[model samples]
Target: MIRSTRILGLAPRVAAARATALWPQLYHERVVDHYNNPRNVGSFDKNDPGVGTGLVGAPACGDVMKLQIKVDDQTGKIVDACFKTFGCGSAIASSSVATEWVKGKQMEEVLSIKNTEIAKHLSLPPVKLHCSMLAEDAIKAAVKDYEAKRAKLSPSKQRGSGGLINFIGDKAAIV
Candidate 1:
């Protein structure tokens, strides 16, 4: 009976210790911030020539992300970015951070963005790593869509298209 009472007393202490140790591993500050308040969560004008739309999904996790980018034709730089993500905390944070990083970056530079960067920034675990990959793929898809649209225009239209500058209000110019 004495041994049973001692074991019961240790249970509370052990549970408290476990909770304290697991708290940080289960949640990252940045991840929680982004998850609660996602950035650039919207859709741009899909039919606009300056807008490139990318829609991607992960079958295993049933996550879907739609990312859009508006480019400056003359400078070949991203002028604005937006995204709508339907997934877990990691997926939402990945897409949110991707949008923030893509704006003001050139198409080529945006393509070079790696999944590792997103994962590291959000402090994602192994299971959530795939969310970063999906974010990267979504950016590439949007860029490809832009390129494809640009290719279809006539030379005169192509030249004129470069003059359409996107106005992204409230977002600071990174460079």
Candidate 2:
């Protein structure tokens, strides 16, 4: 027998197994998995051109999440994702799942992954719904940040026009 089993004996192990079986009633297995072993839980350099960052706070739940995504500028595919969350298990799991899902996906496609889907996968209760929403918001905010940064660096802004100009406006051309 293992040391734990030998010392504590089989009764506790059996009880733990039973509790594991019952724990899913309050938290889904997936949520438990993500919470116990959170994925991509960290920060990337916010100033990095390839990285996009999102910060969301839920005042009601007092949860704050910072999610970051790294994308291939040419391909628009997410190369990596990371998140840091200060909140409940559902919130942590939501962000963790978001990072896992967004990695390797196109930015546009990542936008389609919804809060409902995250909530469903985690079996979140109604009270915890906001947590999932925050995760979704994080993804959008990050993508928006990336797009805005890219726009600043775009070739259209570099055309020998002096300062920034409205590239799409015909009247403002070559000024």
Candidate 3:
């Protein structure tokens, strides 16, 4: 017959099993598996001539995101989009999904993507809204970069016309 101490010896194993069973229930939430194992989470050094880069952050949420887009200059169509994010799971998922959604999209069409769409795509919680905001800002920043560079090479600018001298700022372009 097992003594009380012997019975206590089995208590730990029983508790562990119970904890394991309850883990899924306790942690029930919608999370993006792919973002948890994010792919293409870095830079492309040798992109095409018409590619642009964007970096945006939210100090309040302590999240930073960088988005890069390769586009057909003449058609304003995005051939590729990629992202890097530093934050929680939701932030990473937001950036990841945003990149996928923006790729193969025309500039005008890409503009239609909103932060709410990214949040919905990731099924983010209300507390993680900053993640979607970062994605949205990054897209706008990338487009602005592409447009600025294109403007610099335009024929009108080649005539030494320096009217307002508008400029687009990317990560490095930031002062």
Candidate 4:
């Protein structure tokens, strides 16, 4: 009976020590912060003309991310960004940082954001680099979606001669 009680007491201590030792190895401070209090942790209306949505996943890790952007048509700037990520702390942090980086930036500028920057910012480990890549890909995908939607609404035509023409008001150009 004494041996049993001693074993029970040591079990909790061993577990606590293991967890404390592994915690830092598992996630960085920024990753933990973002996972606990993620920014822009919601979705936008995908059907809204001014909004674009991108959903991407890492098949190896089963990490899924949905990112959205609302653009101002006149300036072609991202007025707002949001995201929903279902993955590890690194993935969540990567997406949260992505939304913050994109807001208030022009579409062209947002495209320049690189995964390496995000990974560096988060101090992500080599194994978790794919999380940052996922965020970068999500941003590009959302921008492409927005552009495609806008193109469908614009006055554009395809000529039988394999040429494309765009008509804006009274002006037309073929390329």
Model 3 per-residue lDDT tens digits across residues 43-99: 755244587788999988788898989897667788878888888777787788878
* Residues 45-132, model 2: lDDT tens digits: 9999899999999988799999999999889899999999999889999999999999999987999999999999899989889999
Model 1 alpha-carbon miss at residue 27, Å:
2.0
Model 1 stretches astray by more than 4 angstroms: 1-25, 155-175
**What value of lDDT does candidate 4 attain over all alpha carbons?**
0.88
Q: Give stretches of model 2 more than 4 Å off.
A: 1-23, 155-175
> Whose TM-score is greatest here?
4
Please provide, for model 4 over 62-161, each residue's C-alpha lDDT reduced to its tens digit, 9 standing for 90 to 100.
9999999999999998999999999988999999999999999998899999999999998999999999999999999999888777766764643424
lDDT of each: 0.86, 0.88, 0.73, 0.88
Cα lDDT of model 1 by residue, 12-59, tens digit: 678678766764578798888888789999999888888899999999
C-alpha lDDT of residue 129 in model 4: 98
lDDT of 1: 0.86
Residue range with the least summed lDDT across 10 consecutive positions in model 1: 156-165
Q: Give RMSD (Å) of candidate 3 vs. truth.
A: 8.7
User: Alpha carbon lDDT of residue 87, candidate 3?
Assistant: 83
Quote model 4's TM-score: 0.81
Q: TM-scores for all candidates?
A: 0.75, 0.77, 0.70, 0.81
